[model samples]
Target: MNKIIEIVSSLDTNQVYAELSHPNSGGICVFFGAVREFTNNEQVTGLEFETYEAMALKEMNKLADTALEKWGLNKVVIKHAIGKKEVQEPVVVVGASSAHRSACFEACRFLIDTLKETIPIWKKEIFKNKSVWVSAHP
Candidate 1:
């Protein structure tokens, strides 16, 4: 019954996973998104993430509520990093738990996909000499 909607400097994957564990849930799905070294075949050094923290968290919570209601999910946790992130560093973590595996998988997928599309977060692709502001929604 707990909803995890947070924006932090770093994402704690283990902690989010722990929060998703529930006796009523038989299946759990987790997703981790890391800063990649390449984008559209362009070499990348790192990434910088920024957000309207209050608005973003509110939107994230709404998504969690939607998932819970639609999928009968027992737990939904979404953690996003707001700051500079190096390559391979986790930027976002989403965990969903449901009584059935199908619901778990669908809810987890929906959480990540909907997050990227609807969240009010912005990102910058950091290159060797320049950085460009990018849209969080892909």
Candidate 2:
């Protein structure tokens, strides 16, 4: 079975790992995208992520389904956090399981790459002296 998708204020790596664990799954690929302290040397302080939740969720699920079909994977889980996030905090996590390592890795990478390009989300960057809005997937 597929795992849940949560949009929360925070995420725990261990908890996410445990949720994706499966007895028949021989390989698991995990990806964590954290809030960076600097973007183009702008000295970022924090970021606020906003999404059209319904549309974003639909796209994310479509990404997972495509990956599963292409890779013949056992399961896939994608979780993203919204709202204000501090530097170094995880913003997104993706996990994929398969019977082999190659498929797992490929699917995981595809999931994240596609998500960053296709998801409809926006991020407001708060810098030390200025702030700006940018494409979340960019």
Candidate 3:
């Protein structure tokens, strides 16, 4: 299965892992990005995420294609949460499965790093006394 993009208010790791699991897949790698409680020393109350949906999906699909081309992986799953999210909530999850552990790990890392840099997503950090909008990328 190749899930290019999924936008959900929440994600389930078990569901993602089950979807990627296969008899032919010898290894699976997963990466999760979560909302932190603080930013630049300010306490965060929550976050509101927004995106250029069409472009974001396009970039995500491209990421999946690149991973498959580079790693010859069997499957990839990318899930992202949109809308209000509280501290500790998962913001995104990437899963990759392959015949070997090396490819799975590499592809998972590549997918996440590329998505953070390339995806057109923005985050508004709601602090205790103020809020600020910033790029989703690191």
Candidate 4:
């Protein structure tokens, strides 16, 4: 499986991870980041996400490439949602597959962690009382 980077208006975690199967890989690790119902005791109703799509897409592809080069993984998939999402909806999904579980896990972790640290997506937290722009990273 090659790197698949999708920055779209919505996301399906299952669909994102479904394509990561590889004959050479014995294990697949996946991570899904969803809109949490609470944040520091505050109730979160929804979230709005946006990005410089072109630049974000480019950065995501680079991150996927890095994960492939840095880890012993056979596949990497990274996808993120744009626009509004209700609670429990997936905001991001990442999957990595390899001959061993550890590599798959590490690659998945690195792909998401690095993406959060370096990507250009912006998020707005929608609370029951108010909404504010927040860094999509972290």
lDDT by residue for model 3 (1-138), tens:
566478777777668778788788999999999899978888999989888888888889989999988998889998888899999989999989999999999999999999889988888999988788875357
List the candidate 1 regions with Cα displacement exceeding 4 Å.
Answer: 136-138
Look at candidate 4 and give me any clashing residue pairs. none
Compared with the true structure, all predictions reach lDDT values of 0.90, 0.85, 0.87, 0.86
Where's the lowest-lDDT run of ten residues in candidate 4? 10-19
Question: Which digits, one per residue and each the tens of the lDDT, describe model 4 over residues 54-112?
Answer: 99999998898888888867888889999999998999988998888988888888888
Q: Ten residues in a row with the worst lDDT in model 2?
A: 1-10
lDDT of 1 at 15: 84
Task: Please give, for residues 20-112, the per-residue lDDT of candidate 1 as tens digits.
Answer: 989888999999999898998888999999899889989999999999999988999999999999999999998899888999999999999
Per-candidate TM-scores read 0.94, 0.91, 0.92, 0.93
Candidate 4 local distance difference test against the native: 0.86
Checking candidate 3 for backbone clashes, the offending pairs are none
Ranking, TM-score, top scorer first: 1, 4, 3, 2
> Model 2, residue 4: displacement in angstroms?
2.5
Instruction: Specify the poorest-scoring 10-residue window by lDDT in model 3.
Output: 1-10
Model 3 TM-score on a 0 to 1 scale: 0.92
Instruction: Name the lDDT of candidate 1.
Output: 0.90
| Better-scoring candidate (lDDT), 1 or 2 | 1
Output candidate 3 Cα RMSD: 2.0
Question: CA shift at 48, candidate 3, in angstroms?
Answer: 1.0
